[model samples]
Target: MRQRLIGGIGRLLAGLRSPPHAVLAHAVFPADEPLSTLPCVALDTETTGLNVLRDRIVSIGALRLSGGSRDNTPPLDYLVHPGIRIPARSSAIHGISDTDVAYAPSFALVAPSLLGYWQRRVLVGHNIAFDLAILRHEAERIRLPFHPPAAALDIGLLYAGLKPRVATITLEAIAADFGVTVDGRHTALGDAETAARIWSHLLPALSRLGVATLGTARSLMAKQRDLLHGQAGAGWAIGDLLPPHRGPQHEGAPHG
Candidate 1:
């Protein structure tokens, strides 16, 4: 308890001491704009492990959406060469072998392009905090400027709001409920595409709930986070909800 308290305080102090540019890099969005009209991107990442503090991102997949339509532009996909060896445990989950990424470009080499792809766009994902945290960690490691998007959306949180009684909120569960097919389950691009499809289904539901803007979506997500945090305690980690292995159908398939 004491260590956690101290760590929280230290993080507070660090944020307080950060430069003005750093503080304002994540610009807030207008609350009244309809979400349907805004530019958005769905992203997913495969990493060395679940610990953001310790894990390294081995792959990234992202696709853009405009005005509720899929943009035909090529998706951003990359295999990153994490400095350390990819652990077998994580490999069993994501299927990213060390040899697969041994010759890939490092995160630093790809950071600029990734940042550009994310610029001025809202980010969406299933359990998105993990991906954002990993991205932030990589940015810090490479001494690159990174500010989170002003408005980020989580598919899991949206589903929970839509069906508060549902006990499980995994990607597969949500996909099943919406009759969405999830191809490429463990791979980053596959997961990203699935997340994008989920978002398409979620927007109308959110609209029906009077959450028609980025601001409202963010507000609801904040409330859900608070409720979950209260129920699970402050120490709860989001990555804990992610399955460590692929489902039966995806078993033995190559991951991102």
Candidate 2:
């Protein structure tokens, strides 16, 4: 009893010391509520490069969804001056050169707006960890405490769950499977909007599979990732199953 009390106190103190914004960002989506009834933001980012430790976010795109209705609120689309040269390789993918963002606001100036858009909502993304990692790195650079949404839904992971035996899980592959056509494939806003549409299509299917809530969906994704890792460890070359695409080169490349 005493040890539990001490642990609880420690957690309380840590929470107290955390930034108010961070505190407010905590979210728990009840299992009883249908996913379509929950509020969420689909987000995406274009970066100078794939290295979260070294690269910077060049742009962000996000749109809000709630109660089965996508708010007509214009998506938040911001171009940021990354304060570094945009590599030619990455520029070819997202088409944002240094000159395009030279006059745009720096991350520090735009952080608050981004946070405002993200606060108190679940975040959805294609390859969400990359975007979140980039955001966290940017906040650290500016000495601001960054708190990501407590819950996130990754469409890529969900797609992986749907096709566990498949080796590759690119956004284009999943989008094609669901018949979602995104005009500007590599652009931030375009990808985010595509992800939103994918989520709409996925929700009902997920519901049929007993993933009717955010928490269940997250759990299902974890299981799917574990299965993929196990398959890879058994010398299954999953990448051989699909063609290549240009996106962030990370642990799960070509997916987001």
Candidate 3:
């Protein structure tokens, strides 16, 4: 009886093994034909509320992206107290109440330091457009010359390309499905760190599936945006194009 049980388990394991013919089909994220390599920042923003035009970012989080193929800096982070009162609902999500930010400097005061870290680097986030929108709004509000980072990326969007038929996609869902830790639940810095870790992990599946480079990933985002939204003229639709939206039509920002 024991022998039979062992044999049954062996067969189950064998059934799970990759087919021999298809094994080794995809290597690491193979370099793309164009866009050799570049710096990337997995970034996140925490806001007082969700309105691209009205809500304010209370904190900013980021981690430097790295892979064996590139030499990049270690992780870094920042926090900004948006010059506004934090609504009760918003405070609950991020744990940043108006009292917490009252002593914190305004976005203008903190922009230079963050900008110094991000210039010429690609931006990454889960649902990155929200981060980008908040960042863009704050920068522009300070009259800081706002230029899109070298590029903006959404791991949430990228994952969809890897598994297009998935019925639903959310950060928590992806983490659970892929055996990743959902650390730092809602904090911007914690979330950014998680985003970077996820990107590192998902690259293998992505490379195998032909999302082998930054350009390919960005291209996928643009095309997917068209499919999902089905028309343009929406501000904040692109990277940091607008603020995160908690309310209806406060403003429709595009995907990053």
C-alpha lDDT of residue 48 in model 2:
85
| Superposition TM-score, candidate 2 onto the true structure | 0.78
Candidate 1 TM-score, true structure as reference: 0.78
Candidate 1, number of clashes: 0
Better-scoring candidate (TM-score), 1 or 3: 1
The TM-scores of all predictions, comma-separated, are 0.78, 0.78, 0.74
Score each candidate by Cα lDDT. Answer: 0.71, 0.70, 0.62
What's model 3's TM-score?
0.74
Clash pairs detected, candidate 2: 167-238
- How do the residues 203-235 of candidate 3 rate in per-residue lDDT, one tens digit apiece? 787778777776576666655654335212233
Which window of 10 residues has the lowest lDDT sum in candidate 2? 240-249
lDDT of 3 at 212: 71
Kindly list the per-residue Cα lDDT of model 1 for residues 207-243, writing each as its tens digit.
Answer: 9999898767766665564444532332222322222
Comparison by lDDT, 1 against 2, better one: 1
